[model samples]
Target: MRHIGKLLLLTSLLTSSLAFGQITADPEERGERGAQDPLRSRTPEGNPLPFMQRLRFGGGISGLSIGNPFSIGVSPVVAYQASERAVLGVGVNYVYTRLKLYDSAGQRYNFTANQYGGRVFGMYEIVPKIIPNLYAHGELESISVQDNYSGAGLPVNRTWIASPLVGVTYSQRIGRLAGINLSALYNLNYTTSSTQVYGSPWVLRISFF
Candidate 1:
């Protein structure tokens, strides 16, 4: 009788284990018991589309340097992305320069110049996040010079020149709509008729736009 009772208890325990396994193995019950996953419900390959894939604009100004016949100008720029790694931009600048000429016995004269330009450029990002950007541009400038001396009777002259630019710019991305950029450019061609100033026409550019 005791052996028979033991057999009956083993049979009951086996039946209970089988019932528990069946309940746990149900697809709906297993799903309910599974842990929540935040990233699992995303689109198939896990890359949703960006709000704007390829459009940007920026602009800024530089400090003034009128002495040494050197001056500063403000430049405003706008761009459109042609591809993932290339961008095309256009810019405008308004500039002024002044020279103070003084002779023996404190005789003094002031000369002023006004210039403006429009530029179109292209940028290629080879190493988008690691180094400075490589760029090239062309500019058309309208220049005028006048003497401010009361009796000098200096002629006011105006002319236009085309300047080619090649440079590298370092950019720090601040956010979706902001960045800091610093650059240096060598002006390719400044004809003798453009300006009779002594300094090289290279421009050092800086901006936050």
Candidate 2:
């Protein structure tokens, strides 16, 4: 009876030790378990987020009416979140521009042209924890425009122009899955000799996603 009693006490001690070890597991082990927990997988709208909630769509539009030249354009983008801090996207743009010009004899005339283009872009979050929604943006664009250097006077020929742009953006969340972003970019390929589509190297843009 004495030996049986000792055996039972030893068994109880072993079970208690095992339970205590499980209850007080290492913090890293607990974190790993928490990360895998399905109960914590939720979207901002309180719905269950899928394994890859990465695709996003956004775009911007601009209209300008200043006397000599008037222009209107639309840009639409489709993006994918590559990681926690990186995003990649592609976009298409169309602009209609009307210009008032003078001939060599000083006669005023109105000219209308259409500009169309496509771009691929990438963005990276800058110090996400410290700077919050700030991001660095880069893009490569190819546009079809009238060749102004082709003997001028209505530009009989069309050409493709390539522009490389770099900038920074500030993002603001408007809803659970929607956001607005403002970016100030500089064109790296801007030159006086080339057919300047944008007129300047600086571009300010506002977009929604």
Candidate 3:
């Protein structure tokens, strides 16, 4: 009878020990399993912001021109992604130039030069993440020259240059939705040199979009 009582007590103790062991080990084992899982969240840190909430803005502040004389330029831009791969924006540009030369006498003369413009641009990515990334680009630009440069020889104070450009763009994404843009484009309006905005038909631009 004493042996039977001892066996009963031992079994009860063993059951209680097993229950306690499970209660203690279950949490640690679950934690380890959670650590192994890639999508499990063990800590309080949350994910990044949503893509729509990620609005980006960028512009150019300085530029240098290399030609007959030394010139400098600056352009500013603002844009928002209209779709998954389309962006629409506007920008403003300003350029300044200076030249010092003398003709007959040894005197010094300073000349003023400038080219200012505003841009309305759109970019749609056709083939993304590949070689020769194709983008459909379009812009309507209004440029203004200084009053001194505007005479019978040149047009007027302001000139509008419109073009539908298609080209290859290379971009590097820094975070979720923000990135830098570098594009080499050809102007489709290759009618005459008088209608062109920049010097050449092929234009290269760097921006943050």
| The best candidate in terms of lDDT | 2
Q: Can you write out model 2's per-residue Cα lDDT over 1-53, one digit (the tens) per residue?
A: 34334433543443232210001123453365452212213443444445345
Better of 1 and 3 by lDDT: 3
Per-residue lDDT, model 2, residue 110, is: 62
C-alpha TM-score for every candidate: 0.61, 0.66, 0.54
What is the per-residue lDDT of model 1 for residues 176-200, given as tens digits with 9 covering 90 to 100? 3345666676667755543432135
Residue 108 miss distance in model 3 (angstroms): 7.4
C-alpha RMSD (angstroms) for model 2 = 23.5
The local distance difference test score of each candidate is 0.48, 0.61, 0.50
Ranked by lDDT, top first: 2, 3, 1
Superposed by TM-score, candidate 3 places the C-alpha of residue 150 at a distance from the truth, in angstroms, of 10
Model 2: lDDT of residue 155:
38
lDDT of 3 at 202: 60
After superposing candidate 3 on the true structure, give the runs of residues whose Cα lies further than 4 Å from its correct spot.
1-54, 61-64, 69-71, 98-110, 132-134, 147-166, 187-197
